[model samples]
Target: MTITHTKAMRKDNTLLAITHLSQLLHYVTGFGGFIVPLILWLASKNDVEGMDEHGKSIINFQLSMLLYILISIPAILLFGLGILSLIFVGILGFVLPIVNAVKAANGEAPSQFLTIRFIG
Candidate 1:
C-alpha cells in the first residue's frame, strides 16, 4: 500500500494579479511575459485556487496576440493595413493584461478578449 500527500490549493489574489501582469514582461525584456506566467502557473496551478483558469487566459491572449502580429507582418504589403492591425494588437496586448490584472486582484475571472481557445 502506498500513500501520497498532495498540497491543498488556496486562494491568492496577489499571486493571481501578478501572474496576469507578468504578461508585460514581453514589453520590458522582449520576452519572459509568457515564460514567467507559464512557469508560475505550471508550478502552482494545482496549489493555487484560480491559477489554472487565469493562466490559461493569459496564455491564450499571448498566443492570439502573437498570431495577429505574425499575420500583420506580411500584411504590411496590403496597403499598410497590417500596420493598423499591429498597432491595435500592441495596444490590446498592453491593455488587456492590466485590465485583467485588476480583475484578478478582485477575485474576478480574467478576461480573454480576442483570445482563441487553444488549450481548451
Candidate 2:
C-alpha cells in the first residue's frame, strides 16, 4: 500500500513539474482560457508540502488573471474608447500567471493578480 502511494505521488509531481502555466496557457486559450487555471488550482490544492504551497500560490495567482479578464471585458465594452484600458488589463492577465508560476517553481508566493487575496 505504501509503495503504491509513493508511486502515485511521484507520478503526480512529475506531471506537475512539466504542467506549469507556460505550457498550459499556450495550449488552452480557445477553451476560454479557463482550464489552465482550474487544473493548476486543483493540483495546488492537493499537492504535498512544498508542492502544495507552490500549487496553491499558482492557483491563487491564476485565479486573479481569470478575474482580470472577466472584469476588463466589461470595462472595455462599457465605452468605445475603453480599448486602451482593456489592452492594458489584457496584457497583465497574460503576464501574471506565467510570472507567478515561475516564482512558484522557485518556492515563492507572489501577490494575487486578480480578485481576492486569501493566500499567504
Which candidate number maximizes lDDT? 1
Candidate 1 lDDT at 91 equals 95
CA shift of 28, model 1, Å: 1.0
Query: Number of clashing residue pairs in every model?
Result: 0, 1
* Residue lDDT tens for model 1, 14-75: 99999989999989999899999999989999988999999998888888898999999999
Global fold similarity of model 1 (TM-score):
0.93
RMSD of each: 1.5, 5.3
Off by over 4 Å in 1: 1-6
RMSD of 1: 1.5
Worst 10 residues of 1 by lDDT: 111-120
Q: What is residue 59's positional error in candidate 1, in angstroms?
A: 0.8
Estimated TM-score for each candidate? 0.93, 0.54
Stretches off by above 4 angstroms in model 2 are 1-28, 50-71, 77-81, 118-120
Supply the TM-score for candidate 2: 0.54
Deviation of model 1 at 95, angstroms:
0.4
